[model samples]
Target: ILHSQISTIEKQATTATGCPLLVRCKNFQLLQLVIPQERDCHDVYISLLRLARPVKYEELYCFSFNPKLDREEREQGWMLIDLSEEYKRMGLPNNYWQLSDVNRDYRVCDSYPTQLYVPKSATAHIIVGSSKFRSRRRFPALSYYYKDNHASVCRSSQPLSGFSARCLEDEQMLQAIRKASPGSDFIYVVDTRPKVGVTTLVCVFAAPSHGMRDEAMLPDPLREPHLQGGFAQPCMAALLSCLLGPRSSWRA
Candidate 1:
């Protein structure tokens, strides 16, 4: 193993975490600055997850940037090159790598300069029933949209219809996650009153499946989520109770 010592500075201003010097370095030549970013920017990537019950596949969409995007596409913004070939290109030895369900209609071309667009519906259900079983899961690290709050019943502004109605009635705290994240739809039309049981909800965003850090900065559960408005106490307690509740009890 290579061994080296980190050089120390005599004086420096500390960050909120109270560490002296904003940048951390491994050696004289290697410098690192850890900028604080939003939590959702990190949390969406998952390798495996155990659900309470069986889950059905829903429409899946992936947002990506194509460095070789054409001029026409570039004129609009970033491009989404089909990454169905990712497993092949990555050269993983497992056959399961190629089993990605990339169905037709699940693709989209994002214009460049802009690196965001809604892809076709995914063929998998990201979340499912019973809360008793485990399943592998994968989602993009970054899901860019024009605004945040698309998942909020109050912010979506859609008429009381199919998707909108479900969003309103769903009691799952995770339901509103995508909307409060960065780069989601800005306007929310549904009401948050029914879901306002918690005054504050803390959401922790971990690094990717490859792992980035032991812990990422998590938002205060008592405060409003990053992009959405503040949460209420009752709501917070209810959600926490569910998360911390006895697992076996649910089944019993």
Candidate 2:
């Protein structure tokens, strides 16, 4: 089966809402898993709405790993090309995209090293930053960061800052978030492990008219029941909430 853990989430104005002057941040965590791809991932599908119109989408972004390439492989030359013609010929979205390194050595963190397919429409932005985090007990994690007209998506080994102390209590972690995201309004939770109880931190750069959302702090008792001495489950919960909730606004 295909398992998913939302690590980060970001949103601002949508095509429906139009671009607004202010931005709000709501960081949360959530995830869902799908069955493993048997074969021909191109068969997987989804849809999108443009200008209140419906558009069918095929082509998917696959996430994977490369034990051969270390951290350095990610930086050099990455490109997000508009593969609309290629996708349309294959019955995919005209805006469908494929990530490529200028050299085309096959990206280290594209999808499942084996390849996990997701609809093209799911990618709201053309370019996405990618990374991988590996823990001893579980499978290596792959994360994708994207940026659109309003929302910016990012993933890190560290947490993002600026929601509220009630939601995220670590000061140092929050500082890291601020450094990574200076002007972003929201952070998207793309990958995370809840059972492991890893805490993620993110920050907000802009605020809407109402100020910010009041998120309920998770109880200390219910979180980090018996994991490591430093692990925090509440942060993972908050990460999921931001990712799976409405794409338009943040709740926490």
Candidate 3:
């Protein structure tokens, strides 16, 4: 019966929106336990990792199970999982459970990392800069930073004095932007700086205007958020509104 169940899940993983499965080995016996589904594959993976607290596995494998791939590729689709590399690449918190821990005190804080798997047809633009306001002791500090572009990834820790960082001119960044249909989705990795804690990463999605250049009208990164540091959400919404205008649905 257990074997039948495992086979069933393995088959589902290749087609349905799948969840992570926990594997245990004891007395030379292996067990696969399916985790509950979450928002998406990424969320499911994170939840399962937290449940397996203080993970000590010597080897971890992630099966693609993508039906679009060839049969041979799907059959041999298992790949080693590297948590550290994934965290860095995805801009995820090093402490898998940190979001939940932080929420206890800062209940308003977002509980997930900022990431977006942009479709190939869409173009993405990134901007990194500091606020115009300065502290008594320090100059404008590094503010917003988020990277989840699977095709091309970039993260910056340095502060930008002005609009010094331009995604349109950067060759590496352009690689992620493609000529796609007008109104296609655009991903923006933004920074949300709270008054009392570290800056929070936020991912914003918008569609480009059909007539205008394939770019977003971003705010002057050198300036302050419209209302202190909580401008990330509004900024994203405004951009989408501007791009889509009144005719299109403003759903991100």
Candidate 4:
């Protein structure tokens, strides 16, 4: 069942532009940040720093893989380390590195889980491994990173029907939305593709029988002419709450 799901996700990813997925971890706090394909390494490194600042996490780890490459080629996964204070001192030297370096340049085994200690965090560790079950379990993470990470204006003023839907699959996001809506009519669309990544795209639409509400209710930023992409999870929740209704409460 899991393998089937992973296969479906890989197919969907083929259609979306690729992007690097950044994971920030400090003690028990873990946040995922998606760096659009258009952003350069420096931009991504800086973004990681910006994300960690508020939480006081001094460092973050970014990872990326190319599905198009063969097994041996794919084994050479990519990783980047962003140390906020270190970067500040050295003016942020290039921090991207190969995943093999975690194993002292040894080739990583795809079939078995590999544990690597994070240099920036003494107690933190990153597991680099892939399996039918592991990929299926964390499918949402795979899809979110593979898909083009961006936000766009709602092309159609109408409700969910014509408006562009954004994916919000992170568990943190779902909990926020569920807490806000509770027993409301809100519907969650979860992408269950077997791929390594999957995300829930929130769709907001009222029935046609109910007349459209005033457009003023939506936040001004969401109505702008350009599409805003690469928003972190908290921002995404706030945006969704605004679109849903005034009664929605966004958790910090």
Q: Each model's TM-score, in the order given?
A: 0.16, 0.20, 0.21, 0.15
Better of 1 and 3 by lDDT: 3
- Model 1 Cα shift for residue 189 (angstroms): 16
1-252: candidate 2 lDDT, tens digit per residue: 111222222232333433222211223333222323422121221111121122222222122433466666753334343343333343322132233231123233322332322223223121122121121111112233222221222233322223332322222222323233333443333333342333321133342111222223323212223233344566455544444444355444
Q: If both were scored by lDDT, which would come out higher, candidate 2 or candidate 4?
A: 2
Could you tell me the lDDT of residue 249 within candidate 4? 40
Question: In candidate 4, what residue range of length 10 has the lowest lDDT sum?
Answer: 140-149
TM accuracy, model 2: 0.20
For model 2, state the Cα shift of residue 142 in Å. 7.2
Number of the predicted model whose lDDT against the real structure is largest: 3
Residue lDDT tens for model 4, 102-193: 33232332322232212121111221221111222221110100001111111111222223222222222223223323233332332223
Error of 4 at 218 (Å): 35
User: What would you estimate as the lDDT of candidate 4?
Assistant: 0.28
List lDDT for all candidates, in order. Answer: 0.26, 0.29, 0.32, 0.28
Q: Any runs in candidate 2 off by more than 4 Å, and if so which? A: 1-98, 106-184, 188-231, 246-252
Q: Per-residue lDDT tens digits of candidate 1, residues 171-242?
A: 222233433333332322122433232222212222112111111222232132222245566555443333
